[model samples]
Target: MATKDDVSQSARGLLKKVKQRYMKSADFNGLHISTIWNSREDLEAAAELVTARLVEVVGPSDYMNIHIRPWPTRRKVADQIRELRELSDDDYGVCLYPRAKALKRTKLPKKCEDAPFAKAMARGRSTLELAFFSADVLESYRNDARFRFGMGDFGINFWLSDEAFDGHQPEKDHVGLMHLGFAYDMRQYDPEVPNTPIVRRVAAFYGDLDDLTPEHQQRWASFQVGDDGIDPHPVWYASQMGHWPDGLGPFARLKPGAQSYQRLV
Candidate 1:
């Protein structure tokens, strides 16, 4: 009676359990990147459109550690946005610039503010992403907002490198990864915990990730992401900042639906 999709999901569920058992056994030593974006097609189109610009401004590099991720804003974080916006301009300039700018670009109906659904927020759509580990690939975007949204409905993807993911344990890698993600998602133990769908998916899927071969690890080192996550820009800042769109947000105004929040409805 099970459909192909159902069968596949069942198999994946079993695999996840097995992986969890492994995680409990070994120390995890590897880097894992969790990325969010709208869709694969949109990601490709956006990446292709900007590839030329990134090369022109940053110059071609043999390798760069860049991750294209959307702003982690959802209707759930409205209060966070308000709080960040309230901070002294100098204290919060990084979080407000893009959001207020993007709001100007969109013709949000007056009613959009009160519905409590994503449709009511300035950018309920999961279009813009942040957290490129290294900026050389798209450095120009650091200052200007207009240049970011040139590709309509653009989203980005991040790659995982085993080199960045090392620790004393291999079996425990997925467990640590899941814990880290959950810690980020928890946001100070706030029960609302937004983006449940996507977050859960990452936790479940991580159990199945394969260990990177040595050649792959060496290839990743070429990106030279020295001490990034420790005080990682974009990631650390975005996590602390709360809302999705702001100075860090690309000038994306279309405001597409958030992938994780959609499933709850």
Candidate 2:
């Protein structure tokens, strides 16, 4: 089990870099999705829609764990990782690719309890990573049954796991360290290839920032509003990419080609 001790000087540098990028992104809504509460019916319906779509992407399985954005208590997602795939070495800590630009470090923010992402921040032994993989590989493997439902090898989590802890935190016990962000690698995909699975894009926040005297107006980051008592059994996020309802409006223009599991597939 990796821990704080495992965090090397180099690793800390990268973690800091990763957080900075996320902080900037949290404030960005242009290509971002925000969490919205769902009615019991809406929640169930959304889950059904999300699950149906996921099944088409990776197929079905019994041990699968799902996280709805902003729902809290996420799965730790270690077993979901496979050996680093096709991505290049330079892609490791660069959270935003052609989409978002990362900011350079200036003065560090004072650690504060109220700051978003304070608890779930990566510290100690955990280092961030990015990966790439194919859908055919996941479908062919038995252990990969749950992966289709999880942030996959090729996704942006390949950019950096949306959530990561220094130690081995299993999916069920995921608390305190709530890393988020799971997007599709829109840049790479092949409709004709079975093995060319869609790469899952991923990134996360390390709730470790502290700005005792925050600016009255705006800040660099914003997270799902709520207390620490978020439920992890199922986490929720807002997305218009696939066939899920996230209260379309500004996000409606996303045009994931209309909802439907088969269409998403």
Candidate 3:
């Protein structure tokens, strides 16, 4: 059995063929998304905790966009936190200042005139997310040298919207969406791309052709799985910055029998 759990012999054969076909069709040159935390529960807990914190500072909103990126030093991050704190008082601050281009095609609600950047953008659209950071959370990273040198763990994101997903691509309408990809000739390519186990299950199960709705059948027809391939940029940066925590590194311990699979084992 190629997978850990026993799959039927027929299913195994079908899965193998499917993977081969998918590889042929998938754009290996594309970028892939990965998570920083170990499990869904942890990720959710962190998000909820951040949401609570943000609510205390900025009034309720409908959405969030967490941004986790490298930082030069804690002082720099502290400086940014100070700026954000000042934004709360300055109604006409940069944080609330509207973008002329964003308002050109679509006029946002009058309420948006005084709302945060996140809420303003979501005035009319179905999805609106905002960038946020918590001083308390920053404290967690302050003492850790890894974060000080830029192996920072997390950031905060918030959003507000009155609409639910209607199955259209939000990326097409949204200006903030980012696409991370590598050229076909890049050296980071891996036959076994890194992904969470949950993603693996969804891909393995939905990937099969045993049953399909007519609409899905058409959608999968000639569908190019624009995948996000392995991104080692963080690891490379961590190593270059001289604080790649190995035994307890963010990307390490993903192998079998490690902490990530302890529950399954």
Best by lDDT: 2
Between the candidate structures 1 and 3, which one is better when assessed by TM-score? 1
lDDT of 2 by residue, 41-157 (tens): 322322232222210011012112111121221222221111111123332210111111112222323432343332122121111221112233222222422222333211212
Q: What is the lDDT of candidate 2?
A: 0.26
Q: Which of the two candidates, 2 or 3, achieves a greater lDDT against the reference?
A: 2
* Candidate 1 lDDT tens digits, 1-265: 2221333343333323322322232221111111131233322322222221110011012112112113333322334333322334233121111122222344444323332222212332222221122323223322333222122122222322344345333432222111111111222243477544311101111111112233322322333332322222333334433534322223332245543333443
Better of 2 and 3 by TM-score: 2
Model 3: per-residue lDDT, tens digit, 1-265? Answer: 1231243444333333322322232210101111331233322322232222210111112012111111111223234334334333223221111122222344433323333332222221111111212123223323532222122221111111223123343432221112111112124445578632221100111212112223322333333232344222343334433554454434335544568554443
lDDT rank order:
2, 3, 1
Q: What is the lDDT of candidate 1?
A: 0.25
Off by over 4 Å in 3: 1-107, 110-113, 119-134, 137-265
Cα deviation of 252, candidate 3, in Å:
9.4
lDDT of 1 at 45: 25
